[model samples]
Target: MIVDSHCHLNYGSMTEDMDGVMQRAREAGVGTMLAINARLSEYDEVLAIANAHDNVWCTVGSHPHEAEKEPGITAEQLIELAKPEKVVGIGESGLDYFYEHAPRDLQKANFLAHIAASRETGLPLVVHARDADEDTAVIMKEEMDRGAYPAVIHCFTASRALAEACLDMGCYISISGIVTFKSATDLQETVKIIPRDRLLIETDAPYLAPVPKRGKPNEPSYVKYTAEFLSHLLDWDYDDLARTTTDNFFTLFSKTRRP
Candidate 1:
């Protein structure tokens, strides 16, 4: 059973014709997904999608991009929202220096709040890191020193140093469709050494579609290509690769029940 460990199902393209999108995923053998929410204001809609679909689960928190606008976000608030059984993770939250969508200090504050929620709730932190690998790794390490919490560097496209830092902290790394790009050979190389237990795959759909599907909108179904590509890169059988990642997802997001 394959799982799309992270995606934005509420994104326009995905929500517009969600049934067909989900049907395609079923047809493609993608059995479950974690529909990530990047803003607290959109929690109801995001949670609605999960409520409407048995195999879908969700998280609640603010993205760095929304950090500046969501000044009231608190670890206690996140813990309260996470009381629902379906709310299995604390964030699609973390730093994003590439866009600087939110002020860096505010982003850091938001990221730390989510980390606190993760530590308090025992739910994994669904991290979304971009060009700020150095600072992101520093914050994650410092927080771990304060107290340990589970986290996954979702849609990872950072440097090898960042990857090693995550692995050393016992955090998981989720590879996305970007690894399929010809220019992403370095990322592919980094993906090579990730221990099987520490590795997972995602499409980051309605966004970065893999090759062949490049330039087209992505969906959970598109995770098939990423998984197939990783199987080739890691020399694992397709079924075994899927099973390994499925187990990894279940292990890390233990709050999510396996179908």
Candidate 2:
């Protein structure tokens, strides 16, 4: 079975028909999903979705775009909020230089808060980095120096050097449907080098649909296409790719093993 390691099912696009969305994911052989929270204000809604689905889990962290608003958020606050049984991870956080919607400084501060929460909770940090490889790497490395924490570079689209650095830091790399894009040659090359044990796959749904499904709203069910593509790219069978990534997901997000 496949697991969509990152997605936003509580977001408007998917929430409008959440039951159908989840049904479709199960039909597509997706056994589990992580409903990522990008804003603290929507924490209840995100948690509600997870509560209703045995196979769905949630996170507690603000996205980089919401950094300014969540500037004072503390690691203790996240830890308190994350005490719920269904919340399994710490973030969809990190820098997004491609869309500097929040001040760089605020983003950095929020990122560190999430990192600290992850270190405290022993939950994997779901990072969303884009066009800010240098600073992202620097901050992650600096934080690692302070003490290491589990993390995964979600929907990665950074320099190969950054990918290598993340791997060196014992972080996992999650590839999204972006890998199936015709223009993703460089990303494909990067995907090729990722060790099977350290690789993950996501849909980042409501966005970045894979080829054949591109130019349309994405959903967790469509992760199969991305996985299939990665299988072909890696010259492994689809089932093998699915099993490896699924295992990688469980290995990293160990809390999901709870009943």
Candidate 3:
């Protein structure tokens, strides 16, 4: 079975017909999915989905885009909310220079707060770094110095140097549908070098849909295509790729209890 380690099932695109989307995921062999929270205000809805599904889990943190709005969100607040039975990760938070929707400094401060929560709670920080590779890497390294915390760069599309830096810090790398794109040759090259144990696959659904399913609203089922492409790219059997990534998800998000 495959696990979609990151997705936004609570988003409008998926929530409109979630039952159908989830049925399709099961049909496509996606046995588990983590419903990511990008806003603290929506944690209740995100957790509601997880509470109803045996295979679905959730996280509690704000995205970089919502950094300004959640400025008062402290490590203590995250730590408190994260005690929920369904919350397994600290964030989908980090720098996003591509959009810069929020001030860069605010984004960085919120990112650091999420990292602090991860350190306090022992949950993997679900990072979302965009074009600000240098600053992201530097901050991650600096934070590691304070106290090492488990983390993963979700939907990684940063430079090879940044990937190497994250790997050096023992951070996990999650591949999304972006890798299946023809123009992502650099990412493909980077994917080849990632250690199997430190690798993960996600759809980042309702956003980056893979080829053949491109331009359509993405869902957890599409993660299989990303996994299939990566399996071929890495020259490993599909089952092996699926098994290893699913195992890696469980290892990093150990707070999740499978039913």
List the candidates' TM-scores in order.
Answer: 0.98, 0.98, 0.98
Regions more than 4 Å wrong, model 2:
none
lDDT string, candidate 1, 52-143, tens digits: 99999999989889988996578999999998888999898999988877889899988999999999999999998899999999999999
Q: For candidate 2, report its TM-score.
A: 0.98
In model 2, the number of clashes is 0
Across 67-104, the per-residue lDDT of candidate 2 in tens digits comes to 98878778999999889989989998999989889999
Checking candidate 1 for backbone clashes, the offending pairs are none
Q: What TM-score would candidate 3 get against the native?
A: 0.98
On the 0 to 100 scale, the lDDT of residue 114 in model 3 is 94
Score each candidate by Cα lDDT: 0.93, 0.92, 0.93
lDDT of 3 by residue, 120-190 (tens): 99999999998999999999999999999999999989889999999999999999999999999999999
TM-score of 1: 0.98
Model 3: runs farther than 4 Å from truth? Answer: none
